[model samples]
Target chain A: GIQVEQSPPDLILQEGANSTLRCNFSDSVNNLQWFHQNPWGQLINLFYIPSGTKQNGRLSATTVATERYSLLYISSSQTTDSGVYFCAALEGSNYKLTFGKGTLLTVNP
Target chain B: SAVISQKPSRDICQRGTSLTIQCQVDSQVTMMFWYRQQPGQSLTLIATANQGSEATYESGFVIDKFPISRPNLTFSTLTVSNMSPEDSSIYLCSVRTGRGNTIYFGEGSWLTVV
Candidate 1:
């Protein structure tokens, strides 16, 4: 089983600030995804980057598969972004994804 | 992208009772996964549901306690049997579309056992 570890278990960012979150996996992964869990417990898919780099608006993610780590960047963050961010990965042929403990982000308005 | 209509957004049930949460996907997805989010905790995988087969449970989850049914590609049900206060948490269902492999989750059903 692959272990997923997220950096900065907790984070605080004032509105209009920027932040970076990192996720490291113990082994090679067949798939990887980033998600945001809102205050109301809704899981929002942020990005599904098994490899390479992707950007959506003010948010961007990069996965260096060789190093088995991924990073998520949020620029000029907003209050609505306050919540826990999770990175999930599936090792080898396992379709079941193992998730990190999560980075609890608190964005002050 | 597909829309998932999850019922009973939130509920409070008495102990010893059971609750079955339903997840209906707009598209017929071959694989659906059930997850549990405990209070102040990260999401944990409960089981994987595939049409025409019984769900494969995770290490701590068992079929008797958390039974899952996937009768077809577009729908699945997860029943929490003999519920207790510890069972109170948010239950979510996610799906993967064919081989593309990015999974998406529903809004989740919040349960409070008392």
Candidate 2:
């Protein structure tokens, strides 16, 4: 079983701020995903980056598989982004995800 | 994108009772997963359900506590047996599909045991 660790258990920022959340894995992974859990309990898939970099609007993610680490970047954060950000990693071919503790982000308007 | 719908978005159960949560997907998928998230905690994988096969449970999770049935490709059910106050949490249904084997989750079934 692989372990996923997310940094900065909590974060707060103004509406126009930028932030970076990091996820470190204890072992190699075949799939990595970032998710956003809104206040209403909807888990939204933010990115599916197993390697390389991907950008979606103001949110971007980079996974360095060789280094066993991934980074999620949010630019000009908004109040809508106030929620829990989770990073889950899947190892081997089991298709099971090991999730991190999550980073709680609060963007003040 | 996969559309996942879960029944009984929220519920309250009594100790020693059981409740079954239903998960339905818009498209047929081979691999479906059940996850649990305790209050203010991260998600934990409970089991992996595949059509026509017994689900594979993760460590610390057993079939007796969380039984899963995947009768077909588009539907599955998870039953929490002998519920207790400690069992209060959010149970989510997820599926992996399309390119990159991306996973998508439903709105989750929030359960509170009293």
Candidate 1 iRMSD in angstroms:
0.8
Task: Compose the digit string of candidate 2's lDDT tens values, residues A7-34.
Answer: 9899999999999999999998989999
In order, candidate lDDTs are 0.92, 0.94
For model 2, how does the per-residue alpha-carbon lDDT over B57-94 read when each residue is reduced to its tens digit? 98899999999999998999999999999999999999
C-alpha displacement of A36 in model 2, angstroms? 0.4
Distance from true location, Cα of B79 in model 1, Å: 0.5
Per-residue lDDT for B101 in model 1?
A: 74
Could you give the interface RMSD of each candidate, to one decimal?
A: 0.8, 0.7
Which pairs of residues clash in candidate 1, taking residues 3 or more apart in a chain or in different chains? none
